[model samples]
Target chain A: MTSSAQANVSSPVRAEKPQRKQMSDMTIRNLFIAPTLLLLIAMNVFPLFYSLYLSFTNYSAIARKAPVWVGIENYVNILTDPQMWQYFNTTGKYTLLTVSLQVVLGFALAMLVKEKFAGSGIVTTLILIPMMLSPVVVGLFWKYMYNPSWGYLNWLMGFTNPSVAPDWLASSWARKSVPGLALFAVVFVDVWMWTPFVMLLVLSGLKAIPDYLYEAAAIDRASSWFQFWRITVPQVAPLLMIAILFRTIEALKSFDLVMGMTGGGPGDQTEVIAVNLYRKAFLGQWQTGEASALAYIVLIIIIAISNLYVRYLNRLREG
Target chain B: MATIELRNIEKRFGETYAVKPFSLTIQHGEFVALLGPSGCGKTTTLRMISGLETVSGGTIHLDGANITWQKPGYRNMAFVFQFYALYPHISVRENIAFPLKAEGMAKSDVYKRVDEVVSILRIENLLNMRPGKLSGGDKQRVALARALVRKPAAFLMDEPLGALDAEYRESMRAEIKRLHLSTNATTVYVTHDQVEAMAMADRIVVMSAAEVQQVGTPADVYHAPANLFVARFIGSPGMNLLAGPRRGEKVELPGTGNIYTIPAPQREVLQAATPEGKNVIVGFRPEAAMLNEQGALTGEVYATDMLGAYKLLHVSFDSDTVVHIRCDRMVSHPIGARVRFDLDPQQVRFFDATTEKAIGPTQSAGTAPISVQAANAQEKAA
Candidate 1:
């Protein structure tokens, strides 16, 4: 504490080392991480496990009553309901359309700007703008653009032949087994907003491929088409899988875009599972028990998709 | 077998020439090495031959057909990169099959070719394993197999052993030479290591500052470098050079009154190449000097280095110059021990002090000095 005490040690500069050694690594790790750890448990972990508990019980937030175990009744009811099946089918169609289009367009765009040119930085920044925008805003903006009368989209379509331009977001869900125009419209907007993210990932993967590989391929007498399929595509596959995994899970939880544009309108044509879950939890039915069960079901589906994707990623890396 | 000829082949990047115009014809089945330090355009020259890099001027003839502007894939020359650029996602079998598959070869035929090639390389165990799982030596074997599978017109290897460990490089060098002996493929190898070039190449092309210093057989280049740069660059410790003005038939050592007598043949060659009493540099390899008490040149050992196979005495003549002399491995030459030595009359070389070109005897004399264009000004500055 004093200069005389410090003088007792020959190397006064390194005296702090002894005090540092007093703190065990475990205690130091906990000391630094305790705040973030507590906050994460309260915000993320508590809700996750508590929701798993509630998935098997009957409880209403508004009723202010303790939850009572319902013995998987909510799960049975939700799974048995044909409306829930329709909503899941709608989400699956949306995910399939959005993720596929995004992967193709993303990979193509990544290839285009792979070699830097003048203003490529500006072009990349412009492309990434949609991903940074609020999803609800994008959804609302596209809904306005899909307006039948005096909309930018319909006006542009009118040039090609106005007669062929059908209603964009007004198709009925009840009369069609195939996804309606409204679902396609929502899928289109999601592709527009998220393709850039996929492009960024693919671009990094492309950058990691050394130039000598291409030179060697050319020397081996491989055509450009052969090189693309044999070299470029395989090298970028792992990162592409990661992009697909992210987009699929995001599409499964599609809510904001549907809420902002169709709002499950045109006779519930675009009622994805997430939108239905929101309605059941908060808006109309106030069925918290069914909502929790649905949430768990979605979580399980995500885990399953993630498991398959992780396996694919591992296989890709192993090569 | 393929014959490749480059007529005045040179490469330029914008205004700077990466390789000054020079020409050489590689005979069928010859293993020619483009040897130089880094950025000396050896790799670029190899790339030009492979058609991966375009020549700024001059034409390339492959088997007497003009292929200067041919696309790399159409040329059918296999290029082995320094880093074995094996297709990472594919197994070794698929990688070796790739070039064949591109030509629309049948699946069974591809497998047969792969089997034959892998058997030669003794890498049958590696066929199913992906390239990532192979060791450095195994990866090199797979790369060689991939190149060999195509039976390409020629092989252009760009420092193929540069990335391997020292032990791997030695074995791989011998393996490549053995493969060349069997296949008899016209191979152009690029390397910075002189030992690798001397060990494997049928002819070594030494280049410096984007110009060809000399192109000759390994022994020829070893004994007869074309200029000062070649003399200084071609050996392990490089050839020792001592500059002195001619005094009759002897070279007058500047500070000391010691005079080195010129041998009869070299004396004739030097007198023919130069005016009387002109300053010239005498070049001799480390082994060319042997201890002689009655020898004209005298020096004390400044340092001693043990090279396992032999010993090197760093003999200091004056304040500025010290030359290495090789001796028997068991011999002891402590530091500061006074020793006199005589240069081997047969192995001694002469270079004009100003021009730096070799004042060489008729038999070992190379062509006139190539005008080294100052493509990069900084090189001259340094």
Candidate 2:
């Protein structure tokens, strides 16, 4: 009976007109998706090519260097320059330090805020204020706090000895350490501010889990540690990965704090790639060609990091 | 297997009592249903037993040990949720293996048990797929399989089939019954649908307004509902009710001008329970109301609902109230046509005007075999 019914209905289903109609319908469906596709391409793709083209040309906003095709000259110079390498190393250290602290502190804050309690809303609101404040304002405020003489940092550190009170913006110690300290300060501020963001996202993710799943886990007589590892972590991973990716992107592009606090420092010791690019463009005698090349280099590094983050995001989504 | 005992379990959220002094003992290997409408404390009772919700005042005992303060895991029972609660990221095999793995079972044994459950649920082909990719019925089977694989003390399910399509729910209902029979596991199922409760539960615990109305076998509850709420709740087309006065020998409906001669014994019981010339509500099952050529109380057929196997003819009186008469499916009754119907006086039930509880001894009527003596005693007490 099944075979006879299948035999009767098979031909009509396989008819050509239905197939043609489906194709046209799909084309019309694709038309609805076109705007989003074009927007994404314009925002992400066009800038990439524009920067790539600028890298080979000596295009400067001030010097207005007519782009002579100096194939890889800027690349060769920037690759070999010790100062450029110094900036790369500085940027890498900042990214690693900031992202790690953000993740750990973010996880802790998320866990704390996830539970229902009195005044949790106020705590969350207070914690989130630092992140929402402008980066430039935060850097300026910290600079005032670390102003060496009347600085709050010195006062807080309790420097009774006038001789031992270290210079924050002048000496070699100040140069190397100030930028790193400022970056750490920014990272601390980032963790303070954005940890709540991570908490909010993770809180929603945690709440989404029906209480029955945890009950099931408990009925298995799972230990506290075991439940955290198996159920809690697995449930929170997808959102955590997304949060980490967002923080990483923001950390790699860190520039405002270093600029406002150290001003690329006692001797270019604190200059990240973004700050270096700024210096080359305007401060270092308006070397537009070198700045364009440096800009392209920063763009390349960001693209590589973003690509890695996107791959992890895609894998998390799939799982 | 474990015997779960609840001693006057009460729960309150803020100021409102969600469950009021609920008490019951679930025997080992028995299938019981907490059946009621939404917000009637059925799910709340199930959660309290599972230790997911804290009881305001109660003691919970499982297998002779008081576990009132114990956490959910210490209760040693598996719960299949209405949402399935299958981790969407995990494969079907892992979802089934989760409880065993959490208990630190060996890898080989976990795999073997997963395989056993997969075969039992006929989901071998779907073992490698994630829950997000499965159909609704398939996901339901996976949830059932996951719950059963643990073979814990008992299973508490909250409307597990509520999300399935009608055909799938029917098939799953049969499958769940078979699963229960094969395993002989104690199960507590919650549902608003009386049909589901009647079809699946060995005993149905009827609840309403944060209180347990009655607990009995499906046949017992259907034939002898304790109050007006249970009577209307447990039956399809519900029980037809008419408000009237019980005179010495006959009860007369004032608005419809219908008088029913009361049996002498029932009249005596009614007299003892209530004052003479007092108003009372009379109730009867739709199937008990039969149409006869030579009967009293003429009414016009308002509507006919054909349900394949049985048909219901809704009859309306000159008064605003209506009563449904169950009849054969193919036996067509035209709407707007006048029909005379007789009430099987023996099958009728009387409830107190103030309390709405069954008031007197009800004789066996229609296909009902059990005398509602217990219900009458309860009504008298009420």
Candidate 3:
């Protein structure tokens, strides 16, 4: 009687749900993925193709005329301009300076913090604040610090000598040459903000390297310096290359930092490609078509540079 | 050649021990294996000898010199890791030459050393490949080549074949033993595999619970375990133990009506070790139980397993006890069938029930086990 009573309770639970046709795995997968796929096509892919089309046409944001198909004229104009070349040269300088300094300082910092000691976790977390910061905020604060009169930098510079605290924003030497002292000021800010990114990458790479490799190397009688050259450096190279790739592109497209800090002032010494593109498209006459062409040129360049680095990265992995 | 000595060396984390104080002397050109289960401090002992781990107390002597504080690099010993930690960014040739290059040898001499090692390992075809591109076996061979190229004072291996599949493990085990015979470099190997330790080691150091349980040759550990742990640890199917209260001439087995008669030779030793009313444990290898019509013990067949060369019959003398016995593979026994078997006097051993240590006169062939003992037992088996 007890067994029949228990069976009476459990049987209806099984019978309550009627059999339903099952969905195939592929159909269910597509059903779940369609929303995300459509959103991506609308938000990202459409804009990308639209921009590619606009790159070949003469279209201005404030103009009264419809966009006219100019075919390669805007591309030709942007490519032939010497000032655009100068902007690219400045972008190249910025990429090179920021990437190199960030790699060196970041990798050194990673090594220093790799060995755990008291408060090391706190140090790592604290260093991530700059990388977490918005570029515009960093630019504004650094701009305040770089002010010539009664600014924090000049106040500190007055310690060495009062009379020789030169103007940072208005120095003639900065405006006289490409990538002069004023450009270095902005480069310094970029490096300050992004060095932690490289540090985190190298830290992860260092962590992935097994302790046994170093043990094996030590047992092989390889000196600490030898181990660094043979094991640590080579082991972390691919990650370092990835860090370089990220920073190079970011530095090339730097707009807000240079705009907030220098505003391409002192006669455009610190104008990177992105800042120049911003000025061309929106600030002055709104040359949107030429700016669009220039943007595509920069995009192609980024792709080429990334392709090279990725190839090198793959080789490092396989080698 | 190098002789490594650890005298009362130990490791501790706060109040707990990773390895309690223990001492052993590995002679020059001898292959010694520190054998135990995971977390048994065998790896820690091997690391201490290699100077990769600093001893919490006591000094380590290398060839009669106190090299306890020496840097691991300056120790001039080669270590092969279990996972084959080859330098991933270099060719196998550069990997083998890494140490020689560090020594500031000329390029030609470095290449010559690398070539010599590759030829010795018969891995010349893999010279140009990176370690990531090699198979597990090939990678291990490259790691071995790297270690051998330096011709260091000694070699330390931490379960070097533990990562290989069964197909490669046997061949690599034989290859490593062959390498040892050819080099005759004093080697310290750490492994938890009894088969590995038994096959290659000149001396096996069986460890448990952060202490050395026993140290003996493979045959000694198998035939005459120094304690119950070694008896349970050394064999594929470990020794069968029957606990009983010791009576005048026979021990009354628990959970069974039968009584065990102490084999004639060890009766005096067994009686002397335990009090008259105290309990003793009888131990025997599976092969030591012989089927006889007028056998001393009778039990029902509890289970049966077909080993490759023999059938293992588990006999239940009562509901609570089952004893494994090896019989001819051609014979079969149904479950619950009565089988009579007698223990071979030569292979029987007795342990004190309280201390879990073997009684004296532990071996029949005089090949006594030295695999047991440590300076401390408060933190015995972990």
What is the DockQ for all candidates, taken in turn? 0.73, 0.39, 0.66
Ranking by TM-score: 1, 3, 2
Candidate that beats the other on lDDT, 2 or 3, i.e. the better one = 3
Which 10 residues in a row give candidate 1 chain B its minimum summed lDDT? B370-379
Model 2 chain A lowest lDDT segment of ten: A170-179
lDDT of model 3 at position B60: 89
lDDT of 3 by residue, B1-382 (tens): 5988888899998999999888788888989899999999988888888889999988888889998989886777888889998988888888888878888899998998889899999999999988889999999999999889888778899999899888999999999999999999999999999999999998888999898887778887888888899999999789998888899779887544577788777788777888898899989999999998788888999899998889999998778888889999987889989888888988888889988988975443766445334456454444
Q: Which is superior by DockQ, 1 or 2?
A: 1
For A1-319, candidate 1 gives per-residue lDDT tens digits of: 6887767774755675777658899999999999999999999999988888888889876777899999899999999999999999999999999999999999999998888999998998899899999998998889888876556897775534434455577863233334488888888899999999999999999999999899988877788899999999999999999999999999999899999999987778899999999999999678788799999999999999999999989988877
Docking class of 1: medium
Question: What lDDT score goes with residue B130 in model 2?
Answer: 90
Docking quality category of candidate 2 according to DockQ thresholds: acceptable
* Of candidates 3 and 2, the better by TM-score: 3
Report the C-alpha lDDT of model 2 over B1-382, residue by residue, as the tens digit.
6888887778988889898875678888989999999999999999888888889987999988998999877677778888888877679888888878878899999999989888888999999999889887899899989888877788889899998889789999999999998888889999999999999998888888888887777876787676789889989978888777778777776435578776565778887887778887878899878888776666789999988789999888765878889877877778889887788876778888788877863222343343112221233356
- Write the residue-wise lDDT of candidate 1 on B1-382 in tens digits: 5888888888998989899888788888989999999988899999898888899998999999999999887776888888999999899999999889988899999999999999999999988998889889889999999999988778889899999998898899989999999999999999999999999998888988788777887876788887888888888899999999887788876437558888997778788777778888888999999888887788889999998999989998888989989988898877888888888888888889998878864125454432222122333355
Better of 1 and 3 by DockQ: 1
